[model samples]
Target: MNILPLIVLFPLLGALILAFNPRLPNRLAALVGVGSIGLSALVMVWLNWLFYLGDGGGFTQTLWQWVTVGDFRMGFTLYLDGLSLTMISVITGVGFLIHLFASWYMEKDLEGAPGYARFFAYMNLFVFSMLLLVLGDNLLLLYLGWEGVGLCSYLLIGYYYQSEYNAWCAFKAFIVTRIGDVFLAIGLFLLFTRFGTLDIQQLLQQAPQVWQEGDLMAEVAALMLLGGALGKSAQLPLHTWLADAMAGPTPVSALIHAATMVTAGVYLIARTHTIFELAPFTLSLVALIGLLTLLVAGFTALAQTDIKRVLAYSTMSQIGYMFLALGVQAWDVAIFHLMIHAFFKALLFLTSGSVIIACHHEQNIFKMGGLWRSLKLPYACFLIGGAALSALPLVTAGFYSKDEILWLTFDHGYSLLWLGALLGALLTSIYTFRMIFIVFHGREQIHPHAGRGIAHHLPLLALALLSTFVGGMIHPPLANVLPAGPEGQYGHLIRVLTEVLAAVVALVGVGIAAALFLGRRRLIGNLMEAKEGDRLRRFFYSGFAFDWLYERITVRPFLFIARLHRRDWVNSLVNMWPALALGLNDLLLGTQNGRLRWYAAVMTGGAVSMLFLLLLF
Candidate 1:
């Protein structure tokens, strides 16, 4: 059965129903919300079964001709392939779990059932938009989904509209991502102008025929697309918004960080690997940005007190690894990491939600301690998720995925980039365990309630299991779908050595975190209070002051311009021409006083003057 359309439609239908009927009871709204995503997930499972049974290639289902102009036509089509199928599975499967969790999380929201319904509506809409983003056959349709998600993010991020900070965070996320969308739109225009087709498959096939490797136009187009990816993925320079996005609910954080908005860039790059390959320089730059972003965000994560902000930075850092994979031409590896990340990261966030609830919404790790006894379920889940996140050797999924990227980087002979990745891995371990120790090992500050429903723990348990075992199992199937990278020419000894070294680095980081946070707490606390340490902490905590830099460079100048034109100086200039015309009319009004004598005298003078001049000639 052609269930692709159903996958996209289910969530949208649910959203529409909820939107039109705002008075839905909490139970009904939760049912509709969870049911829609669950149905979509079911459809995706069927589609995957069909995909495996059939030829493992692309299948396009056209809904209609969406646009036409002379020789140009764009179809509202859904393309099913291994890559998109993987993405859809992640979206719907993980999305449904999140929805289920949200059902419990938002049951007692301040706005009650109406708010619950509204949250689900936006959530469903977001799912629909993301599905559209991944499944669209043409760039135009993909862009529509792109903008759709942005809108939904704005709505959902500020769901608690009463809080000015949440509203600002929503606006910040919207505006920051829009900057990337602009680049993506421009890239699409270039693609159409050069190839005359917006269909992704067609464009990929045509690009090689038309453009040679390293062609300037191809490079420019690739760069533009990279800008979009960078923004969407929360790479360096465009990453500040994500930290603020934690102002939203925990589920929103999970959705954006793990399965949806942030991962869009990785999917886009993987989808258009052909374009990136044509521009090798851009690919190299992708690697560089990934390296820098991962290191930067890792340090930032270390300084964060807020549990969500730490995860936010960690998400950015994790995506940096994916970018690094793409840079090294490990396309399959990138997707593998993406899938693994979605599992653990979502689990981590949801677990954090449970912790937050237990602690009465307290998000500071310093304020949380010795919760392992009280919040046993969440503590265990968090530990599992954190282990996966830190890529703890052969036991977790992240190790397989992340180690693949590192191996690929080394085999490709980019030792410096590989070293940077190693450092990122180390830092990731440090921060992940640091959080685990602080939040679950210290003295308990508050007594948290232990009445979370099955909806909460079930998703946590499912995701925790995935985070533990899914990595090794996914590689074989994922390999079939993605373009294969060249095998390393290195010896078995070298390969084994690299793997061992990577594991050691991760272990070392864990050791350091355990010592600092668990063993020598007073020493670390003293250092944190020291003048130099305090300054350093502030630096990393502020994301290396990128926000301050942007404010001074981008935001301040714009604000200044806005203030300068507060009275609409340009509008005044526009109005000046009309004012000048009116002033001239006023000056000349005396000469045209509607008097017949004045007209007759003027005509007589002109006639006499003409006659005299004619006689002189």
Candidate 2:
């Protein structure tokens, strides 16, 4: 039997068992949940080994035919290639780690409603959906996984249903992403009509032959598909939901928002590279959009006070970089960066979770000061994750992947895009380190009743080790995996120089942040006391009112319009028609009153009148 099916089935079984047995003890449910994902991880590793050994080739396992109609057919097939392998490894690997961390992190919450079993059920379902997403061979199958994930996200986001804000956040995320889904559905229909098939591999094979560069249909398909990608990946115009998604559990934050769910958009683009390549205009648009999002989100991160919100915006900004990579056809490079991002980003969120648990759920970085001594493991892990985010030159995983993306932008002659990305990177460094400095480098802020236990620190220690060294280790193989362009069409020296420039920008950003927030505290303090400084601080702190602008310009007005149309003349017209019909029926039936004498007399008169009228005609 192929190991592929088990990868998805194990999680499905786990979800089923946990959902039915919600009354089980928390420890037992936790054991079942983590064990199931761990088993899946081992199977993925085994499959990887088999794939590597099979004549240096890829593998695909088909369970059965999904559907068939004349010339069109779809199958429940799993395709294992370099790309899918990367995603699976991240899903199961980082996913398992997060699951282990969640066990301890959420133990306290099991005392309330929606106990351990329910939490694990959502987590397991998430694993299964993500697996289906990466393994799917066709677009429709992929959509199934896509919708599955959206459902799981809603469940997890509203896990704490007692909080009205959590439910609202879940609804917001659901509605925002549905906007992208509409475009994606249209794109799939267009692709099927044009190519006569939804199989991604086959579509890729035919796209280059059938569609030339600048083909209108290809461009439309790319744009429509990008609409979905932008929303899922938290790009511009559809990115607000991510900041609010922080209302979910901390492990959910680390697993879904940080590592897996957001990366699905990047994977979609990479998986359908041929379509984008044939649509040059669409690709350029993607790059432009990515650049805008990177700059906007990076700057916004600087203003955030909540630790998770800071990381939330950072996720958006980093994903923008990935989209930029995909737009430039750096498929392997984008996936590589995604892999590295998963390690460090998950580590950061987990460490933050530890810090929050230790401090009894305090999340404001301003409220947290010198925690290095009290929370040594979290401090060390946070530093490791922060270093990666700052792209500390050649030492961090982010440096390897993100630097390559910067290099690609310049080498492709996108000078303005490169400059924008550079600025974004600088802002990323400053904001990332700003949080780090505030939370760990200042005066102690731990409360007296806050709990500190071994359960909280172990995950931090494990993730910290991975965050520190994974980037450098992955670099050698990652470089080889990236596609090399045709000679003379590519610019090698420019690539290297651009990497160096990105590194320099990151360093400078870090330096400036250190000087203001750490190195020259008195100077910054004095500046803060000045009236103008207060205004400037408030401006940045409120994210320059981007969220407010969105509400005023888009969300609030759209809702108002919906309410007006739904309640005004149209609704009245519908009600009036129904009421009018009822009145007409009553008037026509009113003559048949149940009085015997009146009824007999009216019948006799009507019969005589009818006889006279017929005789006259």
Candidate 3:
């Protein structure tokens, strides 16, 4: 129990080691990088044992006094309970798996140069940031950790810095997310000013007493936090950066999209559920945003050709589901889905990484085919991962977690939202299996080199097993920590029907994918070959033209204004002195030349001028 701080410190030390000793032997660097996270996961397992085996109550650990100003004081502290336990479990547990797989994925780079060290350094640092975020007892520490992950996202996403395109992708992610971060900063300030402290438990306790339900301040603060959540989770308007984040290496995509950064929003909202409870309108708004983002991202996934981008959109859609759960006050359910999601989504992304590597780094699904036989392990893992993602009944973990959200949405009387979610589930199956069938079922387009070694096989097999009914059976430690989910207002029969419908839609979607993609893909291919289909394809592929629309209304206009003001009065004012200095130097230069006679004349003229000035004075 006392060693809780060490969980964060281990990864921090690992990052520091790799960062400073950038020339460590390749295998040792891998050991430090992967082993550090492995150690943290080991600590998490022990902590889980102690906490659960004991009274199963929340624990707060104050490591040190962080700061004091007059009467205001805050500590560098961590609070753990069911919610955070579930989170750090995903972070260190799944994060460790991702790190191990990365060692195999990035092995060539490990032999190449210091990039291997830099990559692991950033990886360890990212895990540390995420741990601090989920475990922090105070809002300030959480924000510090929040911004830390943002910086890491920028570094890891722009890892291929030799390419200008990848740099812009990282830049885009940073800038878009920064907008939401500003709103979050202001929200924290609002909370601090209202309560005179930023400790999360204190704030949650004090908020309901300080503000009544539907209070304007409460609503505003909740809205601000939602702004931050949307951006970080890749929800509406701020979501454009996520798909392009695939420009980084596949492992980066897995770490960021699968279990860490994109899920932070769901964690934030769940952690601050009390504050949001006071703001009913904002709570409903959160649900609406989640619904819309899920539908939007799910549709967008259908049009993507690049394998990683497809998974990237799937990540956005899945986080949208988590947000949907949060909106419905299914707090535990949200974290439940979050943990289950971490397993299957990480599985999918890691498998996709191998697929990309197997095809000699080809990412387009249409460009590679008949892989089911060639890459047997990855193909099987993908099938299981894709099935879990699509929420196949009984056998898959996603069916358990995600189906609960749908059932709860109906129980809470959000029937319209339930239907939307059902539609989203259908979309989920179509796009997921669509990727599976296209890449693995068609005639061979490119031969794939099968992935080998324990590093690769271990994560796939482990996550695949977890993506099954076995992982779904893993109970989250959230009963004491969170409010209960919507109790069956609609009763048992309705719940059964809804589950049946959801499962039916999922299977139906898979059948549609098989019909469309398995045999030459001609029916859909003809549709896509048509002018209108191609246009729609481009529209969906462009993320419903959000980027295009943003470019015109936001980005291009801002750039145009920037260009118009590029040489504006401010710059002119700053430049005037330099221009004046340069002009004076040029005038002085005109008085002399390189010629010796010109220099002598100048010297004589200067002496005559000095004498004349003295006489005149």
What overall lDDT goes with each candidate model?
A: 0.89, 0.84, 0.92
RMSD of each: 7.9, 6.0, 2.6
- Model 2 Cα lDDT, one tens digit per residue, 1-617: 27789989989899999999999888899888988999999998897777667654456788999898887778899887777877888899889889988988898545455578999999999999999998998999898998888899989988987899999999999998889888899999999999899999899889989988899999999998998887788888888788999999999999999999999998888888789888989888888888888888887788788999999989988899988887777667788788888989999998888888777789999898878777777777877898898888866777877887887776766778878889999999999888988888777766513335555666566666666656447531223223543232356676667777888899998888888787437887898799998888787666667778988998899999998788688789889989999999998798778889988998899999999999999
Q: In model 1, which regions exceed 4 Å deviation? A: 109-113, 476-481, 567-570, 573-617
Residue 536 displacement (Å), model 3 = 1.9
Which structure is stronger by TM-score: 2 or 3? 3
**Deviation of model 3 at 267, angstroms:** 0.4
Instruction: List, residue by residue over 327-353, the lDDT tens digit for candidate 1.
Output: 988998899899999999999999998
Clashes in each model (backbone N, CA, C under 3 Å)?
1, 2, 0
lDDT (0-100) at residue 304 of candidate 1?
97
In the predicted model 2, the residue pairs found to clash are: 370-443, 397-471
- The TM-scores of all predictions, comma-separated, are 0.92, 0.88, 0.95
lDDT of 3 at 474: 95
